[model samples]
Target: MARVLVVDDDKNTLKFVRLHLEEEGYDVIEATDGRDALKKLKTLPCDIAVVDVMMPFMDGISLTKEIRNTYDIPIIILTAKDQIDDKAVGFEAGTDDYLTKPFETKELVFRIKALLRRYVDSESDNDPIRLGNILILHENYSIKIDTKTIKLPLKEFELLYLLAKNSQRVFSREQIIENVWDLDFEGDNRTVDVHIKRLRQRFSHLSVPFSIRTVRGVGYTLEMNQ
Candidate 1:
């Protein structure tokens, strides 16, 4: 059974949602606020989370950022705020989807099922593109060269994954930023350079057939070193 974590300050809402989710054959976990949700995440792993934006001691946006950095689970923000800016902020914080409050239980259930299916299917599709004998696991967020398992910071991992996926295809720095950072980023271009430097340092000792080659005046690509 897929476990769903529902975080809301309103106890009545939690009870209502939990009852419906349980009836649909999902294991439901409850938290009164974002802080409590994080605590639950540390011990109780859930497949996805339904988080409310307005809450005491750490709102849903902040919680979504933290979860994106640490966990691989999907988040759906439940909020009464229907303004575009609010939704933008939630998306920038890495929420998988957004649902405004006064929502129907049927719609909520349908969204949950859809998001889970979408993420699962995408994970299978990515399938860890291999370059120069190095395997990049999209779902696992780790790189493997031979028997060694190397973990990277979130940004560094994302950069590496993108390049690996498009091996031999050059990606300009602008394209890299657009894809990896999305629209909410305000960092300068050097951000990609710094991450590339770190990735090179990590893979330096590995005997891989491919390397991240910098194409001056353009961008970068993972190319065969033959």
Candidate 2:
């Protein structure tokens, strides 16, 4: 089973999360603060971490940065519903995802599963994905089209990799946001549109065999040309 480290100063919150996560078949290790969490990390191997924004001694953002520096596991930050700035800081600190407080247990489970899948994919897939003349190197976060190699930002590379890995599969705007961003992304459909537009602009001049096509009211799909 996947071992999860859950850190929060509130005893009630920790109990609640532990109970629900344990019910979902996860091995949960609880810590009352960031210091305790680091102590636990020393002896325990955790698959992922769920950290709350508010904590004594060390806050979640600081702890996330420490974990990012030391561990390769994914982290999910828990924040208050209105603490938008916390989410931004958490992202900057290297959190893989965030869950707003007053969240459902099912949503937490979903995010954990999603992050695990992504973590595993990155660890296992070392070979570049090739589609005709286009090559996607996941490790380098770059793509090669014909003779030109372009390095992209983290999100752009993930978005392109998602679509290209599942070439010809249609993904709705909501689905794209959920997969590329997070399930709790505060942005709207236009975020996906902007990213899509940027990707198109980047490779518009190339003689590529695949195109990211918009499916009207449906969404976007990377269609391989015949």
Candidate 3:
């Protein structure tokens, strides 16, 4: 499910938006003001953020700027102000879509889905995985970090590719083996760990700390700073 953050000063507005988003099978996180919104955003991972333009403590424009600076996640601006300048300012602050107040719940839902589709489709268009200072050319099965080139065996390369493809999400060793290696590869799960360790070593010299994290008793994840 997609995680969405809704920010609005009015309690009624926040509740209403959260209820509608939950009804649509989305995981909703809410904040009553822009400052609260930023705090919540940093605590959890979210796919998109819905922000109200006229918020307390900080406005949507400022909040959008902060979000854009740290993450490439999609943002939709919700507001009572419908002026052209207001819309332009939101876009300038990196909002992916704009919605005015009193919008129909269905219309809001549609806009959110459209924005998400566009963002996801753009990522798919890239074909290869690129993050921070590292790039993995999946089609060519090659990897590079800035001006440095790294070599990998087929197994190691495939393992790195899968982790980087799904970047921040955790994956169990069994899941990694099934997707990166053969479905029926009867090797020990430890093989997955070995390759991940090697890949991290090659990337440790880069500016961004790209590490393969071990989620104890759960799995592993590639956490790249970008």
The model with the greatest lDDT is 2
Model 2 Cα RMSD, Å? 7.0
Stretches of candidate 1 exceeding 4 Å from the true structure? 122-127, 130-226
Residue range 120-223, candidate 1, lDDT tens digits:
55455668777766778867667888788775544567788888778899999899989876654544576677677767877797788888999999999998
lDDT of 3 by residue, 20-108 (tens): 99999999998888889888888887888898888778998999888877765778788664454666566556565667777888988
| Rank by lDDT (best first) | 2, 1, 3
lDDT against the true structure, each candidate: 0.80, 0.85, 0.74
RMSD of 3: 16.5
Counted clashes in each candidate structure: 1, 0, 0
Runs in model 2 with CA error above 4 Å?
122-179, 182-184, 187-226
Candidate 3 weakest lDDT stretch, 10 residues = 117-126
Give each prediction's root-mean-square deviation over alpha carbons: 6.8, 7.0, 16.5
Candidate 2, residues 1-226: lDDT per residue as tens digits? 8999999999999999999999999999999999999999999989999999999999999998888778767889999988877876676566767789989999999989987876656556556899999899887667898889876644567889999988889999999988889766774676677678767887898788889999999999999988
Candidate achieving the largest TM-score: 2
Comparing 1 and 2 on TM-score, the stronger one: 2
Score every model by TM-score: 0.60, 0.64, 0.55
